[model samples]
Target chain A: MTSRERAEGPGDGIPGRAEGTGDGTPGRGERADAGVPERGERADVGVPGRAPVIERRLHPVTPLRRAWAPLAVLAGWAVHDPNAAQEQLARLTDTMLLLGIAVLVPAAGLYGFLSWWFTHYAVTDTELRIRTGLLFRRTAHIRLERVQAVDVSRPLLARVAGVAKLRIDVVGTDDKDELAFLSEREARALRAELLARAAGFAPETAREVGEAPAHVLLRVPPRELARSLVLTGATWGSLCAALVVPTLLWLFTENVWTVLVTALPLLGTAGASSVGRFVTEFDWTVSESPDGLRIDRGLLDRAHETVPPGRVQTVRIVEPLLWRWRGWVRVELDVAGSDNSVLVPVAPRAVAEAVLARVLPGASVPAGLSPVPRRARWCVPVWWRGHRLAVTGPVFAARSGLLCRRLSLVPHAKVQSVRLTQGPWERRWGLADVHVDTGAGKTVTARLRDAGEAGRLLAEQAERSRTGRRDAPPDRWMTAR
Target chain B: METGSLDGTGAPADQPVWRRLEPGLLRVRRLLLAVWAGVFAVAAGLLPGLFAGPAWAACALLPLVCAATCWRLLERNWRSWRYAERADDLLISRGVLWREETVVPYGRMQLVEVTSGPLERRFGLATVQLHTAAAATDATIPGLDPAEAERLRDRLTELGEARSAGL
Candidate 1:
C-alpha cells in the first residue's frame, strides 16, 4: 500500500520522474548523494533511500459525484411545479426542453471535470505539495514536520461512490487543505503515508510502521451514545422550548396551524441534531497506534481522525446532569488544527481516565481539586463548591459548573499564557479568576479564588510552563527515538 | 508602586517596575470622544428637530452629559493601564471596573507588531501588540512613544526567537 508502488496504476502520474528535472525531484543520483542513515532499513523493506515522488489527480468519478447534488435539485424543481414546467415546456417546445437538459448536464459535467483535471498533489521528500485552482493557481506546500493530523471523511454521496476526502491539518494554519473524492483505498494509503512522514520516518520504514495494526481500546455502544445525546443540556433546553412556545402561542393567537408551524421547526431542529449526533457517533471507537490515538466513527459519513502526540493542548471531561446518575462522561480534546475533538463521546469515568492517560502520556484528571474561597459564595451563590483547581507536575486542572460538572486540564508544557481577572464584585470580595491559555483555543479557568492565591498561581504557572517546555520531548517523535 | 513581586521571590527589589501609558493618550482619547460627541449631538439635535419639532432639539444635551461622564472616566481608564517588564514574562494590567492582569512569557511570543494609526501618529504614540500561539492572549500596550515602541518590538522579537518553543 506504499504510495510509490500504488502510483504505477493508471490515471496516476509521476510528473517528477516523467519530467526528470523538476524541483525537489527524488532522482536516483540525488538519493545516492544525499545518503541518509536509514538507507539500510530501506533495503530491508525492499525500498531504497527515497521513494519516487507520487503525484496523482483526483478520482475520475469525482465529476459525477460533484454534480449530483445540483442535478438532484434540478429534477426536484421540475417535478415540484408541474404546471410551471408544462407552461415553460409549451412556450419553448419539447425540443427546447431537451436542448436545455443537454446543455446543462454537459456544462456542469465539463466544469467539474475541468476543475478535477487541474488539481494535482505530490508527496515529496520534505513536503506534501498540493497544486490546485484554475485561473488563480494556488499551491500549498505543507512541510512534512508541520503536518499535525490527517483526516479521511466519507460523505454519504461520496461513500456511495466508493470514494473519500482527505483533509490535511498543518500547524499554525486555520484552514485545512482537502483532497476531495479519492478512491477509499487511495485515500487511506495517502493518509498513512502522510502520517508516517510527519512522524519523521523514511519512506520505506514509514510503510512498515504505518501499516502496523492498531489496538482497539474502547467502543461506545449505539444505545449508550443515543442515551447520552438525549441527556445533554442542549436537548433538554430545546425540548422545553418546543413545548412551551407552542403552548404560549395557543393561548394568545388560538390558531392551531400557527402553533403547529412554530412547534414543528423547534421540534425538528432538536430531533435533527439528536439524530445527527447519533449518526455521526454511531460506531465510535478509539484505537491505540504507534503514531497516536486514532478515532474511527460515524454510521453514515465514516470519519477517521488521528490525534498525533504533542498536538493536544487540553483535555476536557464533561459530566452532564443526567449522565451523572448513569456514571458516564464525555472526553473532548483540544487538538491543534482539528475541530473534531471528541476523544470519547460517552464512557465510564474509569475508562475515560485510561484513554486520557494514553493520549497525554502522564496527565490525569486529579480527584481532589482545591475548592474556591468561601468569600466567592457572594458571587456564585450556588456553584462556588464546584469551582476548584489543582496544579500537578505534568498538567494544571480546573473544575467548574454545578449542574454539568466540567474538568479541564492543560499540560504545563503546552501553556501559552496565564491570566488573572477580578471584577468589581470580586474586588470587594478579594477574589479573582486564574486562566490558563493554550494553542487549542480553550482556557482552563480557576474561578473565584482568593486574590493573593490567584496571583501566586499565575506566577507559578508561568514559571512551570517555562521549565516544562525546556524539559519537553523533541517535536519529531520518531527521529528522537 | 505595587510592592508585591510577581516572580514569587517575595523581595522588594524584585517587585515589578510598573510603567504607565503616556499622558498624551488622555488628550488623544478626549479629542476623539469630543469628535464623536459632536457628531452625535448634531444627529440628535437635527434628526428629532426635523422630524418632531424644534423643541426636540433639547435632546442634544444627552450626548453632552454622556460625553462629560466619559471624559472623566477616560482619565481613570488611562491611569489604570500599566505594564511591567519582568525577568521572563511581560505583565499588563488594565481596566477600571474589572482588573485584568496578563502574563505573556518570552518563549511563547510568536509575533510582535508595532502599529500607529493616523491620529496616534499625529499624537506621537504607537501601539505594540504581542501575539502568541493562543488567541485568547490579547496583550496590547497602546500609547507609547514611537522610539520605545520600536525598542520593545525589537527586544521582544529577539527574545522570542532565542527562546521560541514549538506549539
Candidate 2:
C-alpha cells in the first residue's frame, strides 16, 4: 500500500506513546519510562510500557558522502579525457562538463538532503519505529523482542565524521531494520539500550547504554594478521588478479605500459580494499560483559558485534589444510539473525576450545563418540581422519574432513530435522548418509555414513527432534534449558 | 516390493513398500521432451540466413539424437522414481546413474504445500512439498492424484503437529 493516498497515522495502537514525530521526544510520561537500561535490573521496569518513543534524524554530514559520487565521476573524466586539442572543441567539452557539474551538484545534494530530512526514528518500549520517505512516506516497526542482534558500524567516512550506522536484525527473515547516519554517541547509546531492552526485558532505570569494559578473552595481533595473510588462500586471489590480467593484456597490446596503465586501477582498488579489510580486523579481541560476549574488531569499517549467551543456534569449527597442520581452526557462531559471525578468525585449538567452553557452558563432545560403521571406509576413504559422532544428553557432535578437521555442534533442543540421503555409489556399497538439519542452513551438525546405522540414526534422530520441538521454550530459540 | 537388510554400514534396514508415481507422468514428460526436440529441429531447418548452410545436416540430426536421449532418460527416470512411507519417516529414491534416496521425518515438518501447474492440472496430477527447518530435510512428491495428494498432505500435517511438540 502507498502511504501517499492516506498518510499512515503514526502509532495509533501504541499506548500513551507519541506518534512518529520529527523531533526526538517521547510521550508525556515517556521520559520517566524512557530511561533505557544500562547496568542493572532497571531494564525490566522500562520494558512493559515501551514504545519507540524518541524520533531523531540521521547524521547531518550524510549529504557530503551521498553527494560525493557525482563529484568523483567528474574528476575521473578530467584526468582521463583524451580529446582536448582544438580550442573550440575543448571549450565545448568544458561547457558541457561545467553544465553537467552544475546540474549534478544540486541534484545529488538535494536528494541526500531531502532523504535525511524526511527520515525519522524512535525507540518504543517494545519496538523500534522508523518512518522515512522523500515523497511517499513509509514506516517500519520492529518488535523489540524479535531484535536478536544490534551491530554498530563506523566505515571510513563515517569514522572521520564521527558518525555510525546501526543495524538491527530480527529472527526468521533476512530483513534488517536499520537506523543509519547517527553520531557515534547516539549509535552506541541506541545499540546498548536497544539490545538491553530486546534481550527479552529492560529495566525502567537501567542506565549503562553500555560501552563498559569487558574481560578480554582473545586478541589477534599484527603478527598473526601477517601470518594469516601468508597462510590463507584468499591471498591467491590477489596473486591471480595482479598477474593474469596483465599477462593477457600484454599479449594483445605488446606495450608493457599499456598493461600497467590498464591493470593498475584493478590492482590498486582490489588490493587496497582487501588489505584494508585484513588490517581492520588485525587486532581482533573477544571479551565478556554482563550483556554477553562483546566483540571488537576491524580497521577502516570498524564493527562492534554483541552476541548474548545461548543466542547461537549452532557452531562450526573448521581447519583449512594449512591451518590444520598448525593445529589452528576458526570458530563461527550461527545466530538466527545474521549469517555466521566468525567467533574467531583463526586460533590455536586450545584457545578455540576454551572460548567455546566459556560461551557454551556444559557443552563438550562426549567421549568415545560412536565411530561410523566399517563400510564407511569405502564412502570416505579418510577413515583415520576422525570421522566420528556422538549424541549425549545435551548436544550432538559430528567430526569429519581429511585435510581439514571440522566439528559441528548442535544442542538437542535445537535439532530441526533429520535426513537420510543415499547416492548411487553408496547404494552400490549398501551404504547411506544421515544428516541432521538445524537453523543454520549450510552447516550440518551430524552426517553419519552407513547402511544400518543410517536407519537407526534416522529413527533415533526423529525421536530426538520430536522431543526437542515438543519441549522447546515458547520464546523463540533463546531459552537456556 | 523388494526387501533389503537394515544392517549398519552396508545395506538399508527393513525395506518399505514402494509406490510409483502416476503412469500419465511418464507420458507427460515424454511429450514435453518431444516438443523440445521438435523446436530444435524446426529452428535449424526453417530459420536461416539461408537454409543451405554448412550446419544444415548436423542441425537435422539434432532432433533424432535429442529424442532418443530423451526417450531413454524418461523411461529410466520413470522406473527409478519410487517412494515409501515408513512408521515415522518418508523415503524417496530417484536418479538412473547417480541414484539418490532421501528420508524425511514427519516430526520435523513445518509446512506441507500442495501445488499443481496448468499442465499438471490438465493431466490430473499434483505435487506435494513437505518443509522442515533444515533445507536438506525438505522433500517434494510429484505426480500424485489430486485426491491422493490432498489426503497425504492432511495426514502429514496432522502427524507433523503431533511429533513437533518440543521447541
Candidate 3:
C-alpha cells in the first residue's frame, strides 16, 4: 500500500502541472515541476469559484524509488554469491541466480510502475477521493470535515528526488490514506490547501498556516537530543551495546554464564533501538501553527505532522525513573490520527506544566488531581503517591506507574465508552479499574479504592462523552492567550 | 470496604434489585451440552477399536460425567447472571469465578435491541441488548419475557433519547 498525497497547493489550481508546459517528460528522471493554475485550466474547473478536483497521478519517481529494493536484492545475490556469477551456464540450476534476477528485476520494476500509475487522488469541494489498485481496484471517499490531519513527509530518496508523501488521517479508521511521491513543493502547497479546507476554509482563501501561527514550542538540537537520550534510558541501551563487546571477549577468554548469552542479544537489541530513535528523532521541532501543533523531526527522512486543533484525545505526562531524579517529564498526546504524539519529548517539570496549561488549558496531572483512597494503596503500593484519578476539570485524569510516572488525561467530550472491571485480586482489595475509552481504542483506566468512585467516574464520563460529541470544537487553540 | 454505589446515586434506597433470567436458560445450556456429549459418545463408541478397553470405557462414560458438570456450571452461571436497573445506569454482574459489574449510563446508550432465537422463542423468552459507543460497553440482558423485552427496549430507547449525549 503506497500512501502519497499531493495535498499541497501549487497556488490553488493544477498543482502537479509542470510550470511551463504539461510536457510528458521522459519517465526516468521524474522531477515534478509545481505550477500555478493557468487561466485556461482554472476555467476548465467549471465550478466558477472553487478549485477543480484534478485527478493527478503520483510523481513518476515513485516507481523508480520503490523498485530500488528488488534491484538491490538482485545485485546483492550476484555480489554475495560471486561463484554464481562465475558459474558456466551448463544447466538451468547452474544459471539459477541469473534466471532469478531476470525474473525478479523486471517484475519488481513493473510492480512499482503499475502501483504508481494506478493510484490517483483528487479532492473535491467536500471530499478527498482516492482510486488505487493494480488488480483489486478500491476507491475511498473521505469527507473533508472528518479529516483529522494531513502530514507531509520525505524520506532520504524522496528528499533527493524533491518528492514528499502526504498522509491524511481520518476518524475511526486504522487505514491512513496516503499519496506518496508528490513533488515536495506541490505536497506542501497541497497540505496547506487541504488542511485549510479541512478546517472549514474556502480553497482560495486558505489560511496557509491554518491559524495556529508558527510559534516554536520545542526544538531538540543534537546536544539536547544527546541529553534526552541519556535522560530517556537510551544510554542504558548504549551501555548494553558496550557490554556486548566485553561479553564477547569473556565468552572466548573465560567461563561465561548461559544467562549472559541471552541477555547480551536482548541488551544489544534494546540499545540499537534507542540509538535508532535518537537518530531519527534527532532534529526535533514542535511549533504552534494557525490551526494546530506542527511537529517536524527525523534525520535522513524529515517528517512533518500537522495536528489540527482537538486532534488529540488524551495527553500523557510520563516521567521515567531516571527523569524523576532530575524532575523531568515527557509529554505525549493520544491522538486519533497518529499513533502517539510527543508534545514535549522531554522537558523539565515546570516547562511541561506550563505547556500543558497553554495547549490544554484545564488539564491537570496526577499530583494536581485527587489522590487514591488509602485502602487502594494495595493496588499500587510502589507508586501509591501517583496512583490517583480525578474528574474536576474538562476531562478525567489518571496517574500511575512506579519506575515511570505516567499521568493520562481523557477529555469528557471525546469519551466513547466507560467500563468498570475488577480482577479477583482487585475485587478482594475492594478496588475496580474504570476504563475510559475513545473510538480509536485509546483507553485510560483509573484504579479506585472506592468502587463508588469508579462507578461515579463511569457515569460522569458517559455524560461528558455525550456532551462532547455534540459539535464540540476540536480544541481551543491558544492563538491569543 | 463499602465502595461507591453502582450509578453514583449514593446507592439508591429503592434501587431495583437484580432480576434473574428465565429458568429456560438452564435448559438451553443443558441441551447444548447434551449435543456436544452426543458427539463425544459417538467418538467414544469408536475408540475401542483403537484404544485399550479401559480407555474406551472411560470415553464411553464421558457423556454422563460431562452432563453432570454442565448441569452444575450452567446452574452456577445462571445463578450468577443478574442485572439491576438503577436510576442513572443499568448494572450487570456475572461470572462464576472472576465477578464483573458493568455500569452503563442511560445517557450513553445508543441503541437497545430485542431479539429471540428459536429456543428462546419456544420458551417465550427474548433478550434486551444495549449498545453503547464502546463495544465493551455494549451489553445483553438475556432470557427475558418477550413482553418484558419489548417493554425494556421501548423504555431504554426512550431513556436513551432523553439522556443520550452523543455517539
Model 2, A1-481: lDDT tens digits are: 0011101122211121223434233243344435544421111223444533445667788667656677577567766764543443557777797897799777877898888777767666566777778777666666665544567778888898899888776544333246667889988888777766665444563335455458989997767766765676656667677778889989988998899897898687567646855866667888887566777888767888877655566777888777767777889777665643788887888898888876665776566767766766676676544677877766777887766667788876566666666766677777766677765555463443667777787777766654554444333222244
Score each candidate by Cα lDDT.
Answer: 0.79, 0.66, 0.67
- For model 2, give the TM-score of chain B: 0.83
Clashes of 2: 37
List, residue by residue over A1-481, the lDDT tens digit for candidate 1: 0011121122111111121122333342333423324312111111455445555688888667656688678688887887897777679967887998899888887888888777778776556776667776666666666556778899888899899988877654434257887899888888887778877887666655545368999999998898888888887788789889999999999999899989999998777768877898899999988777799999988999887777788999999888999899999988767778899999999999999998888787787899888878899998898998999999999998998899999889999899999999999999999998998777889999999999999889988997788666555566773
The local lDDT score (0 to 100) that residue B149 gets in candidate 1 is: 83
Candidate 3 lDDT, B37-136, residue by residue in tens: 8888777866773676655656667776877777798899889888877655677877766656666766666556777888778877788777654555
RMSD of each: 8.6, 8.6, 9.2
lDDT of candidate 1 at residue B80, scale 0 to 100: 97
Tens digits of per-residue lDDT, candidate 1, B23-140, equal: 8899999999999999999999999999999999999999999999999999999999999877677889999999999998877876677888888989999898887778899899
lDDT sort, best first: 1, 3, 2
Docking class of 2: incorrect
- Can you list the residue pairs that collide in candidate 1? none
- Tell me the TM-score of each prediction against the true structure: 0.84, 0.73, 0.74
Model 1 misplaced regions, further than 4 Å: A1-52, A72-92, A171-176, A207-209, A230-261, B1-15, B38-62
